[model samples]
Every structure is written in structure tokens, then in C-alpha cells.
Target: MKKAYRIKKDKEFQLVFQKGASFANRQLVIYYLEKKDQQHFRVGLSVSKKIGNAVTRNQVKRYIRQAFIDLENRIKDNYDIIIIARNPVKDMDYHEIKKSMQHLFYKTELYK
Candidate 1:
């Protein structure tokens, strides 16, 4: 994802997690909150140690970012979104990850 669209700050992640609504499946959990003043959406990703070591976690993040990139134009704007990887996520390929993510986005009504 682009730097401008990526949610990098600790506070931002916390704010989304605490205030945002969330949806989850076997692969990932998504948390999102509307930010009407913003011009675009911002996204954050979290992969726990239980999912894998550093390398696997990074791979999972990359997959999630790629999925977001593909869906970016179709998603509703002006929201903060966070994706958290679950244990089963480590075994998923890019297509599976993308499918899981798309499902979550739809469930959250973030896809426009």
C-alpha cells in the first residue's frame, strides 16, 4: 500500500481497534471506523507471533497489502481499516488471503 494510505502510528491503530467495528473469519479480522473528514482511507496490518516468526509474519503483511492494493479503488473512502492475521493465515496463499480480505470488506460494507 502507498505510504499515505498506510496507517503507521500506534495511536491510530489503537483508535481504530477501540472505536471501530470489526468482522472476522478464519483467516483475518478487520476493524474499520469512518473518518468523514479524511480524503481517503488508511489501513493498518497486524500479524501475531502465534501466526508465525518474523519472516512469516512479514509475508502475511505483504499479502494483505497486495490484497488492499487490488481492492483500493473499489473500497469506500474516508475510513481507517486494520487487518489482523489469525493462525490459519500463515498457510494461505495470496489468492486465499485476497478472498478472505474481500469477504471481510464486504461484510463490513466497505466495498463500494
Candidate 2:
């Protein structure tokens, strides 16, 4: 993901966690908060150490990012979003991860 669309600060993630509404499935949790004045979406991704070692966690993060890249333009805008990966996600393939992400996002009703 590009810098402009990434939520990189701890404070921003906290704000989303505290104020946003969330949706989830077996492998992913998604949180989102509207930003009326902003013109685009910002997203954050997290994969905990419990999921795996550094290599596995990073791979999960990459898959999540790829899913986001495919859906970003189709989703509703002006929000700070966070995606959290669960331990069970370590066994999933790219297509499964993508499907899981799409399903969770659909529950949020934040897509166009």
C-alpha cells in the first residue's frame, strides 16, 4: 500500500479501535471509522506474533495488503480502517485470505 493510504501511527490505530465499528470472521477483524472531511481511505494491518514467527506474520500482512489493494477502489471512502489477523489465518492461502477479507468487509456494509 502507498503511504497516503496507510495508517502508520499508534494514535491513529487507537482512535479507530476506540471509536470505530468493527466486523470479523474466523481469520480477520476489521475496524472502521468515518472521516467526513477526508477524501480517501486509510488502512492499517496487524498480524500478531501468536500467529507465527516474523516470517509468517509478515506473509500474512502481505496477503492482507494484497486483498486491500484489490478492494480499495471499490470500497467506500473517507475512513480509517484496521485489519487484524487471527492465529488461525496462518494456515490460509491467498485466495482464502482474500475471501475472508471480503466477507468481513461486507459485514461492515462499507463497500460501494
Candidate 3:
């Protein structure tokens, strides 16, 4: 994802966590806050060290970013969305990760 579309700051992540509505499945947790002033959606990804080593964490993040890129057009354009990967994600491949994320998005009505 582009720099403009990513949430990279600690403060921003905290705001979303404190104020956003959340939805989850076994593999992922999503927290989304509506941002009416923004022209498009922004995403933050979190993969804890507990999930794996650096390479594994980065791979999980890459997969999540790819899923968002593929679903860009279908996702709502006015929210700041944060995705937190759970332990089960370490065992999942790209497609499984994408499916789990899609489930959470649909549950939260973020998918259009």
C-alpha cells in the first residue's frame, strides 16, 4: 500500500483502538473507525512478535497488504481500519488469510 493509505503512527492506532468498532474471526481482528473527512480508507496492520520471528511477521503483513490491495475497490472508502493478526494466522496461507479478513469486513459491513 502507498504511504498515504497506511496508518503508521502509534497515536493513530491507539485512537482507532479506543474509538472504533471491532469485528473478528479466529485468524484476524478488525477495528474500524469512520472518518467522514477522508476521501479514502487507510489501513494499519499489527502482527505481534509472539506470532513468529521477524520474517514470519513481515510475511503475514505482506499478505494482509496484498489482500487489501486486491479488495481496494470493494472496501468502503471512509474508514480507518486496523487489522490484528492472531496466532492461527501463522498456520494460514495467503488465501486463508484473505478469506478470514473478508469475513471480518463483511461482519463489520466494511465491504461494499
Predicted model with the maximum lDDT: 3
Predict model 1's lDDT versus the native: 0.92
Query: What is the clash count for each candidate, in the order shown?
Result: 0, 0, 0
Give every collision pair in model 1: none
Residue range 1-112, candidate 3, lDDT tens digits: 8999999999999999999999888899999999999999999999999999999999999999999999999999999999999999998999999888888888899977
Q: What does the lDDT read for residue 65 in candidate 2?
A: 88
Which tens-of-lDDT digit does each residue in 1-112 have in candidate 2? 8899999999999999999999888888899999999889998998888999999999998998898899988788988899999988999999999999888877888788
TM-scores for all candidates: the values are 0.96, 0.96, 0.98
Worst 10 residues of 1 by lDDT: 1-10
In order, what lDDT does every prediction score? 0.92, 0.90, 0.94
In Å, residue 38's CA in model 3 sits off its true spot by 0.3
Query: TM-score for model 3?
Result: 0.98
RMSD of 3: 0.6
Model 2, which residues run further than 4 Å from truth? none
